[model samples]
Target chain A: MTDTRNLGSQTSLPTKKLKFHKPKIGTAIFLTVWSIYVLIPFVIMFNIATMTPHEALQPFAFGWDEGIQFKAFSELFVDLCMGFTIFGAFLNTLMYSIPPVFIGITVGTMAAYAQSKLTWHGRDFTFGYLMFCWLMPDCVGMGAGYMWFDFLGWTGTPLPFMIPGMFCGVAQVFFLKSFMSTIPNDLLAAAKVDGLGDVMVFWKIVFPLTLPAYWCQIIFAFIGAYNNYLGPLIYLEDPATYSLQLALRFFSVFNKDNKPAVMAGNILAVIPLLIVYLCFQDFILKGINMGSGLKL
Target chain B: MEAENVEALEGVQAEIVERQRKRRKTVKIIKQDIIGWLMGGWPFIGAMIFGFIPSIIGYVLPFMELHTFDYSQMEFVGFKNFEWLLFNERSMFWLALKNSLYYTVSVPIYLGIALFVAVQLDKHIKGTGAFRVIMFLPTFVSSVAMSIFWQFMFDKTGGFNSILGLFGVAPIDFLDDELWFMPSVIFTGTWGACANSVLFQAALANVDISMKEAARIDGATERQTFWKITFPMISPTTFFQMLTSLVGALQVFTSLQLMARTDTGPNGAAVSVVLYMYNMAYQWTGPDYGLGMAGACGLMYQTVLVILTLIIFKTKKRWVHDND
Candidate 1:
């Protein structure tokens, strides 16, 4: 437990332990003003999504004379989105996102363990290489990314995303390495003396110690994969291959100027992500929102 | 003769023991290497293949003059592609270059605001956690959705303008005006700035309260204590946040595209290096000589980033407050 307490500082949790005192009205005022700025967009989104099409002309009115209508939500499912529904888009997004992250998590844990626990001749050099890999192919031009992947016979395929995302998770490895390194080396040495091999030590001791860290990376990976737009836009031009983001983008374009429906589709597109966040908020919110740095 | 034979046998046995030890060391080296490779090497290879190979290809392709992306027919053209990007009237490279820098200019401002807000939130204020959640909500929402919402807000008769109109100010077409388009994009960025505040919140928590108490006991004023101690304490994380966000800001794509709700904003004001690269590759249907050109411009942008990052790192010792 003492070993795991370092997790708090390593990831930098700034909650619960800190003492608090009564703040003045100025703190209340400033926080409220900022909170409005943060949350007003969500309010506007919900307003537009539930508004009648006529009232949507004044989308920011925040009034509902005809009351809130769920019609746009239904219509978004039925006739909006060209031919695809939000659920289908969600599935397509899952196909593109979830598997790579699941695989990346396991791979990242192993890589992180090896990085922090193992000794090899060029281990630090390998760490440097992984950090270099973290520079990522984001700098790859859309045309060049396409052409390069096409040259490899992977253009218009999921392989481009899956291949890179699953393996090029050096950021997660770097993050998890920080967590894994905090586990005392003496524990592993003692385990080894008791006949536990590296693999067994990892499985029996290191993994459980670092389990919470995995969820953090997994959430990061899932959101990253879910929100990926340009990758699919360049590689998956076919409507069938579109990720949720690409699908919503094209859905609005394909549908004939139905503002409320588009707004509703936007709302639907964000639901699963919000659910994922809420589910993992306990662990992640504690950890300084590593997300703010990793992506944001 | 008997004594000499015994000594020779003992020497032979010692040599055999040495050989066995050498073989065991060799086996141990191979085993450790194998374990390292098994755990981490495969993913490292995948990273190299998918990351470095494409990047190197992208780097090399720009120097060739090929109508098709095909390499066999590509003729080496030196810097012709770069010359086109710089000199071509039709190219939007300069606008993208300008816009990329303009977007990054908000980093310090937001980070400053974040640090200030973090100090306030670090107090035992009720709902600070809730405030943090609200601030980070934008991260969960896709940029597409955020853009669409902001697009309406920045509309001529939309939320912001209407509020302005109540004060008798005339409406400005934020998305269509070149002056306002980039500003509107920057405005959308303000909402996302809260994300950094969350990070700073953690950084503030990690600062040494004891140091602050010591400063106060020494008769330091609150502001003086903050500037002299707390600020320096958080400077490393601040530097880190600045580095990562600058990289992210340079790659700002979705907002510029989706907010203006155009392929390019008014008079190409919203075009980013990545967006322009997308245009060169995807928009024209003919032979993709533009592909190489896209590669050229992208390389220029990355080179600038690399240089800029190196410069920032070089300057780190001056401001980053290493806790030695």
Candidate 2:
């Protein structure tokens, strides 16, 4: 249907029409260097993970007995002292992360649904208030959160992490609510006429439609809670209740007795997140489109 | 009289039916309202307490001296901590603020370079997805791991300086030097933040092709099209990135914490405001809870950020384009 002769000229006309062109040789060279720059750190991390401390320190000249220190992983799982182990830290992180995921999703969905579906006065003001939470730095209120948690007798408990996390879950609500708004209003009306209540509508109709975004929020909340070092560092005094990030920080320092193991431990700790991102890269992009600024 | 009685009975029946229907409608509406509230209520309540309350408390606490061990000992410090922050040479607050500024400057410079590289890959170049994945890989890597990797790389005789020798540049002590310390951390941090730039590049890809074509047809150069057309479309994304980057730069702890060797670093060369706050609260053997809470200062931090946000928002009308 189209003219083939014009196609080439149509696309190339801009460049051909122009008299001057900036040279891309500099750009090409820069790309090469930048690619290498991005790659080298990752390559070095992988290399260090696979080698002993003594061997890792060796000038990364490729051929050095093909050293592999896979035992450092087992050491993390095996080593325990005075009721503290790497597994305990992993569990602690899970404890800190899981509640917030549930609570954040729960609270965020409610606020979003209220804002989107309900006819309440000052709804916009409520949303503006929530957005203020996202705008302010989280650390600004840490001292206060710490004091409040202490007052509630929940300093060392998982409640401190989960409670504050729910408050900060406005981002998720913002994402889910916006996604919820895109749903056809007719479907909701139909359901309402069929005698379905709002809760059933949210659960059966709205929530199902939003599962993808919900999952994305879940993953985000989990990772954020998982990687939170400062919260646990301040609120959690008991080493038994320390998060994975805290443990990793601890291991990086206190494990001076076993440096290779620490490096290997670092690799192991990060692998699960890599696995998650690799699997959900597409969803992450979709999630980003839905909630642009909230991406950590 | 019999006809009048029949008419009255009919009227009564009609009225009964109307009342029943009205009741049913009211009940249904009420039920729906309850379900909606229940579905969303707990989260809102939780947010009100933990989310809203602490922010108010954060503002209020800075003016008053707070002690965890002794709650009754509260007194109005009345900007004494701020005075200490401004005039006290021993306090690392000003230095930390300086470091944060330097860190903030690195964001635009690095993001610009990263955006430039990303545009190259965005040309539907071979293995674009793979390159994206590789670039994004560092973002997934834990800050701990990334910091450790940097520490190893710059360890006095490590490959960083060794590689510098290839360019005939002498080995400069990175971790120890006061000038180089923050810059080295910033450089390492910017290396991994390429993910944000790539994401921005993807957003740029979504930019309307017609505008770009129009620019091209108008005898505009590629650079001109990019500056006038493409960049404006992506301004919202850039603004979003800048906000997050500013917040992140202000709260910089992990990289500095790691590089400064939380245990071994000097008396506050690499100590950020956050790290200082941490030290004041927990790190010291006895832990100066009062001083820490005094210094866990929010007013200046909030004031500066709020001002920055206002400036950006005010200027946004000029730069940020909303297609809608």
Candidate 3:
């Protein structure tokens, strides 16, 4: 006991190890207000989701009215076709999201490899031009895409939405390029000396190495393609071809009276994203965390 | 063994040179280039055809008039569309333009506040991640979803009024009144904008912690550190947010479209540019496609955005810091 006390005294050194940083009153107040401000919509949505349609349509009250209305979920499923069948829209989202995810990852890997590995002429210039194109407002090309698709007589089809979404994004190229640049050039040289063909080196070696960046590109491509509104809004004239967002837009149409069920629909629409966020929480956050940092 | 290795190296070098020489031959180079082009070609071709070429067409279309749907019977109207838009008092162009400006100017303010909120969440406080996720929930919620939520929140008998009641303040008409329309739009807009704030937070986290420590040790206040050090470090992100925000502001379609049913203040109040364009093109039977095209004019907007970007880039020295 005496030896333990002596050892503890030696380590303590009669100095305070922890220093507290005082929290500012102004910031505390501001954060409280900001937190409430951010919580308002979520509270409203969460409350509305539980309220009966009549209660929802009724003047808002502070406390819970008639307990929870879990029937909204069943109602949404039942009236699915009334406001773009939630299941169909969900399927449509998957269909739209999958192809771009694959194409973005594949083509992004190839382009990034060419830019980083190949000493081909005009590589930097080409890459820079692509980045420039990425900066252009998506709306600038939107109307033109509509006109072009109209001329092609492919306006109402899913092709316009899916194909352009698959191949056209420059953000993926920029992302993958930054990732590929980090790979050591010595690896490529060694692989070449080992008699690996360019294609073999890429597929067998370089491709496997860039999986993290590939996942990043996949998540981005999936989200962007799935949430696409303006393209489908313009190019797709058929109701049947309506994307989930477009389907949701049908709910916002306040013809005779407001459809509060659409609020339920909106809440339900976000369910898929929540699932995605939960499943790929790490990749989504990591992707976003790294995306802006590596812009150079 | 050394000699054999040298000879092997020499043979490899010769083979490489011969291949390079063959690659230099015009025909062979052209063939290989075609293959290369094909491999890297789809995206470029798609971008040019779908994006570049079409924009060029769109740019020139306002200068010409399609008298009918016939390609052969087109007449060049020169600047008539521009004249119609600029000088025509009957058109809703000025009102829409004003509304568009309102939308554009509100973004920086919204985004500024958003950044501040983001900074607060990034302070490593308890429940910050949960708050970030909750705030970000609205972003994943579609605009249609946003409109629904806002409609409920801002309803006369809605949450806005209830909150107002708690403070003993009378309810105000949010959606119907012209004076309140843009503010309501901005309010709804800010609700869904928390995702962007989280993105800023993410960017801020990536900022070198050492710099913050250095600033702290130098006795800089929190505000000073934010403005002098943190702000400059995250300027790239700020610029990106500004650019995207501007683009989103200019294309303010859905919100305006939803809000259109509500009565405008006396003489045509709440119509935005895209709404006005839609109204002209589709609302009336004598569809003034030319007039609609004039109102849907993107070139001026594009030029302004491009110039703003260039200006920002040029003046980046004042704010942006890239630590080598």
The clash count for each model shown is 0, 0, 0
Give the DockQ (2 decimals) of all models: 0.33, 0.33, 0.26
Superior candidate under lDDT, 1 versus 2: 1
Per-residue alpha-carbon lDDT of model 1 for A52-116, expressed as tens digits? Answer: 87777762466687798888888754634355676577788888888899888888899889888
Q: Which regions of candidate 2 deviate over 4 angstroms? A: A1-36, A57-66, A80-83, A120-122, A166-168, A293-296, B1-32, B66-68, B165-171, B263-267, B285-296, B321-324
- Candidate 3: which stretches are off by over 4 Å? A1-20, A23-43, A62-64, A78-84, A138-142, A254-260, A294-296, B1-35, B67-74, B127-138, B166-170, B206-218, B262-270, B278-287, B290-296, B321-324
Query: How do the residues A110-136 of candidate 2 rate in per-residue lDDT, one tens digit apiece?
Result: 667777887544566666766776676
Look at candidate 3 and tell me the lDDT of residue B259: 52
What is each predicted model's overall lDDT from 0 to 1? 0.76, 0.69, 0.66
Candidate 2 chain A: worst-modelled 10 consecutive residues by lDDT: A1-10
lDDT of 1: 0.76
Ranking by TM-score: 1, 2, 3
Candidate 1: list runs displaced more than 4 Å. A1-23, A79-83, A135-138, A289-296, B68-73, B285-289
Candidate 2 CAPRI grade: acceptable
TM-score of chain B of 1: 0.91
Query: Which of candidates 1 and 2 is the stronger one according to TM-score?
Result: 1
Q: Tens digit of lDDT per residue, candidate 3, span A207-226? A: 98898878767766776677
lDDT of 3: 0.66
Pairs clashing within candidate 2: none
